[model samples]
Target: MVTKEVRLQSTVAGLTADGRVHTLSVWFILALRLMMGLAFFQSGLDKVLSGEFGAGGYLTGAVPDSGSPAADLFVAMGNTPWFVDFVNVAVPWGELLIGLGLLFGAFTRLAAFWGAFMMLLFYLGNWDVAHGYINGDFAYMLVFLSVAAFGAGRILGLDTYIEGYEIDGQPLVERYPWTRYILG
Candidate 1:
């Protein structure tokens, strides 16, 4: 018993150019998560395998000139063996863990939060506004923020199941309601 008007309404409102069909729509976010995750994972893995890879040169270079506020801190930490060593270990491990968490959709919001925080640090540490006030790290931070805000994990990630995960007597969501903020 479909009428011409009903069919016309269905066709007209089915989709928009921005793909705002529903809030759960995350087809595009899935691709973005995979891409960002792989980028981080590869960078970390490369650093891990590179035998001669040292944080000295990179940290030294990250030190901005007289115009940057972090110049002193970066300079102070640059040549320090302990600092370099700590960064060398922490950077790779953090990247790997965050990348894996994002890619597998495990602890997705937490991962993305950390990802954004790390990117924010990079953004601050590498602030070179003297050039143009634009940096890729800032852009990456925004992407991570967007993914987290959109609950991208529910699309094709473990978050979907974890969100609805139940326990022996009460559902995990019921027992630990705070998981709603953490997992998604």
Candidate 2:
């Protein structure tokens, strides 16, 4: 746990149990969470809303014609019609849901996980874009992973309240590693 101190001009002063004032860069965190959520949500929404999604056009083009290095790998994964069709339909909507959840600080951790998973798929699908270290897909994946790990939603949104009452000091959270990963 981390603690911050806020000093008021008035004489009234209080300390958290950790002996520090409660303070955090809530604005900065909110900005980061919103941007991250929006980016992921938009990507997913674009995929689902567009007819291109589930059309298999991009997946097919992911081959040599698409110049994606991971074309062969994707081809292998796409062998299943279900997988191919699911990506087309599911990815975009999933992203949109994730974005909405993150935006509102609802189930933030789950959203982050889904976002990270989507990013992983993107990285795998667009390996051709991995031109050296600046692979945008990879970077996005990392960001999502970080969000999942850090519980970004609790920064300035409803998740903080959820954690304090519904989840705070719970045995499940204290004992289970995955519990903390959830938005609470």
Candidate 3:
């Protein structure tokens, strides 16, 4: 009987531990969202402020001996005038928006999805052969996917408020049907 009682006590302890973990996980995502958002925002700002920044140099340098398909895409796009022009503007603006969305916890999943996409490109573009260490992009991709999967914004974001938003005494859905994706 004592052994059965001990087992029951241990089971209760384990259940409580699991509950604590679930409760605390949101805070971790909140931290990730803030830090990642700031990092992306700063990178974009640096590019926007720099007068001589161009994607061509980086893209051209991505030529790889391993014959990565990603390398081929970068090399091909490096020379096109339109691609260069578009990338130069898009990189900064896209980073800024993604950062804002993540920081504010508005459209958290969509922003995280794009962030992961950008990280994938970075992962491919900067694959180092000599260095055995995994690149930062892989970590960033997982972080983004986690954020989206957990809906990190709801914990400490405008998203929670947006869900409760009322416009002119009408429900959020009444005012705009599309906001469900952004708010949720």
Which candidate ranks first by lDDT, i.e. highest?
3
Cα-based lDDT for every prediction: 0.75, 0.69, 0.77
- Per residue, candidate 2 scores C-alpha lDDT tens digits across 61-165 of 655465666777677656768877777677778888889888888788888888778777677666655357457777877777766655677776777766555
Q: What TM-score, over all chains together, does every model reach?
A: 0.75, 0.70, 0.76
TM-score order of candidates, best first? 3, 1, 2
Off by over 4 Å in 2: 1-26, 63-69, 129-131, 165-178
What lDDT score goes with residue 52 in model 2? 71
The per-prediction CA RMSD against the true structure, in angstroms, equals 7.3, 8.8, 7.9
lDDT, candidate 3, residue 53?
67
In each prediction, how many residue pairs overlap at the backbone (N, C-alpha, C within less than 3 A)?
0, 4, 0
- Give, for candidate 2, the lowest lDDT window spanning 10 residues: 15-24
Could you tell me which residue pairs clash in candidate 1?
A: none
Error of 1 at 39 (Å): 0.8
Q: What C-alpha lDDT does candidate 3 achieve relative to the native structure? A: 0.77
